[model samples]
Target: MELRQLAVFVAVAEELSFTRAAARLSVVQSAVSAAVRTLERELGAELLIRSTHHVALSDAGRVLLPEARATLAAAQEARHAVEQQRGGLRGTIHLGILQVLRDHPVSAARVIAALHARHPGIAVEPRQAGSAVMADDVRHGRLDAAYLALPSQQAGLTLHGLSEEPMVFVCPPDHPLAGRAALTLADVAGEPFVDTPEHWGTRIFSDLAYSAAGLAREIRYEIGDLGGVAAFVQSGLGVAILPPGMIDPVASVTTVPLTDAPLFRISLAVPAGRPTGAVTRRLVETALELRDRTPTPAG
Candidate 1:
């Protein structure tokens, strides 16, 4: 079947509405319907079952959707490959980085600068985003690569470990436990805590660490980022457990090692099972080189 027909089928399968798919493709509904019909006739299978009130994918459609997407991606990659061969590694890489990792060592800026210096034709657009969302973006081809915590096991993605920073306890300098040599989640079980929202990667690490220690963290305030968390903690609003790299240098806030905290792993992840473009490969190599040069944070 033609790639155009497959594209229409994929659009219809995803939107589940001929009208919506037409709008998405910027074509008329009749053109979309005719394309799907042509694809169905060529494949000798009914891809979708449409009714007056509802439209759903048939078993054949469900089976072909992923294959269709892969085919389309491969075709796009082929075109990109030709363009790169002619122009020498010229393209924009949509990259995502965790907000906290921007200025730290092995930072996104370092990676982008290295890539740019090596290949000025390569354009890098960096966006600060949450790790979970970034992982999904990489998996779906929305992002070429991302610097963030790797998902435990996300399909269609490859994660390369960069560095693992230990989580630490932060409290006001005058707090009773601030002077402790070492602490655990249980040490601050009853203390007010300030941290990011539940969807944050740090929050996931905190939840898992506390659960493992059989202690419940009383998150008194939910801050959007580590800067806000540091502000709240320094103001005596609550204590916080955060990556050592995320700890602020505020004179009034002290960071203590968590004796039983999870390591905040930073990884460079990319979409799996696809030919990575030249610019994206250079970016990944730069990140790996930086990771080698940087030391892991101690607890």
Candidate 2:
């Protein structure tokens, strides 16, 4: 029932490995095991199913994981509140940033810079990953907040729209579709496309767009970053549909507007129904303020 025991159990439940959880908590493996055992003894039920090589959460663990996270979050919020009243906020915020947005105006760098200027005591730890991974990290309490490109509604998370731009088609200068003023999904249905992996935010958005139009395109090249996608297109490997500003002008590629393309949106995602600590709240506010001040990139 102790907060320390609950914290240890939650770490093990999330990592699903005693060694890894201990490493994350900066404690020894035996200490982590002892804490989990003490928590199970008090709760009267086994929380984790442990084996020599693997660890899995039992039904009881599954039921307690979310509650444990909420409890820990509440306790942290209480501490942050008292600290804020005393002088200023001081805590580390684990933040996730989408790789595609590394060059964008309202990127993690700008947001972190602004937040730091306001609160010198707060520290931000930025992790770069795809939007889907970032969203899952936020939902599972691995990250305090993340910049994500996702649909309007995601389970167990809240998304705040920051910027939106229409998706555009990019191809080699001599490609057939490059001469067109605009394109529809059907126009590119049979062509080979260069796209990110299926889990990436841009890929997910394009998939939904094609599905809505009852069309499917072949993904010929799978690149992890927008720059690489542009390179593949410039080399005549395949065409791509990406957000504005993603395909640099220096690349010998042509960008054509889509007639009814899906909007590529960037949003701020946080865990739903959880109390926001003072540090996290201030960071969110600063991000929103900066987003409003920055101009939207042209499509």
Candidate 3:
């Protein structure tokens, strides 16, 4: 009636002895005997006749042996088919991303291109959102994976952090620090700053950078988009502390390091304990690889 029962029946039928069958099945002989007895009781018939000296199949046992073997084979096949996905050679996968990566641009497009090139049937589903919202998407089934600048460390969540692109100070090209060979946070500490919305991860990075320099950032404007903040700085409105990813090399704006800002890393957020498919795995790898093309710290 059950797969295990069928396996036991086949083993006992082949071995013609419960002891050999239990040893082959790695179970006690009494367990094998009890299983055979249960199988017979379920069928309302005895399938084997055993004595102190010999064991042989009864008429019912002979009738059921072939069917039991066939059933076990079918069960094995079904299990194998169900497990084929684990081999990690195919399948479509979903991916999510923050609306803006700290310093990476169109991060999904690069990952998608790489996944499609290697695996034919694979595709990427991208969701653009803030780090807070994206974190939830990865937790729920809505997203297969995501990129997070800063995310809450929750159970059932996994992270693969790729690189650290710390927040830096930016100003109009005509500003005093813009003409220097290198600049520091102290250079712009006295000026009004374009700051993150003072809510979460991005904000913490900017604040820490200035705090490390022994100065509180003079944030004059607080907005969500770093690119927009850069544009505001380019207008000579004020100098700002911005992440390396947020700047697109706008001609009028110049970016400089904040002396010793805490490294704001970019991490790939995935649901913990869920199996990763081939496409999803490659996409994360591609994102890590992209980091090489970005600026590296001064040696």
Candidate 4:
């Protein structure tokens, strides 16, 4: 009935002698006999034929040997898997994020690759959605956690600021302000502007920068995606203030820093009261490490 009993049974069944099985198991011959006898009684079958000169399997012994061996093997494998999970990590980590990271291209792949390297059994599943929706899902237990630009104040969410990336203004290289050492938000006041949708987290930095500079907002157009906003500016349609992740398509656009704005913030979001397990914490930490290691784009 017990795994130990089955283990002894398999050893005795294979060796066909309690004396040899005891040597293999590092137990006394009498103890081995007692263990095998206990197994026989629990199974309600006589498992061996033994006399003064020899030992052999009974019909019931032959029938149960293979099954007993199989059971012990399976139990050992299950124990190993459980131990691995307890000591290292093994399971799927459901990760959620917003458009900025979802479209970042290397972001998810990098984090997943790191998980694979460090713990092959830890599977990373990346999901993308709006920031508010990201929070809602984590709060409801739909997702384990997320890398999102945190809102100013949100109940039921714990935000950890991993790092901050300063926002920059993008314009055609030939634009008048592109040559400045550093520009203020007021300097771009009247320039036709293209930026992320006002609902986006980065928009808070943009709006706050404009308000502090006392510039009337004059946006030529609003785009939901930063890539699109970058492209629009490269084509000379307008200027845009964007985060670093949006700098990929800059054949013609010039990015200049806003010396007086709050840049942008990076934070991890998890349900305040939900328990964060080991795998969940690793995924979040991996995300933050990925951002910190991002390569500076070539000019």
- Give the best candidate by TM-score: 2
RMSD of 2: 2.6
Candidate 4 wrongly placed segments (more than 4 Å): 1-88, 98-106, 151-153, 212-214, 288-299
What's the lDDT for residue 12 in model 2? 88
Write model 3 residue lDDT over 1-299, tens digit each, in one string. 78888778877876788887887678999989988999999999999899997889999999887677566546644554454556424454666665453435436666677667765556566766666666666664456687776734656678876556656767888887876766666666788887666544577666756666778756788867767777788888887765666565654688776656557766788767445543456677776676556544421
TM-score of 1: 0.81
Measured with C-alpha atoms, the lDDT of residue 91 in candidate 3 is 51
Name the candidate that leads on lDDT: 2
TM-score of each: 0.81, 0.89, 0.58, 0.61
What TM-score would you give candidate 4 relative to the actual structure? 0.61
Q: What is the RMSD of candidate 4?
A: 19.5
Query: Which wins on lDDT, candidate 3 or candidate 4?
Result: 4
For residues 52-95, what per-residue lDDT tens digits would candidate 4 score against the true structure?
86778999998887687567546655654685868756767678
lDDT of 2 by residue, 83-129 (tens): 88898889999999877534686687888999898888999999988
Poorly placed runs, candidate 2 (over 4 Å): 15-20, 23-29, 49-67, 101-103, 295-299
Local distance difference test scores for all models: 0.81, 0.86, 0.68, 0.72
**Model 2's TM-score against the true structure:** 0.89
lDDT of 1: 0.81
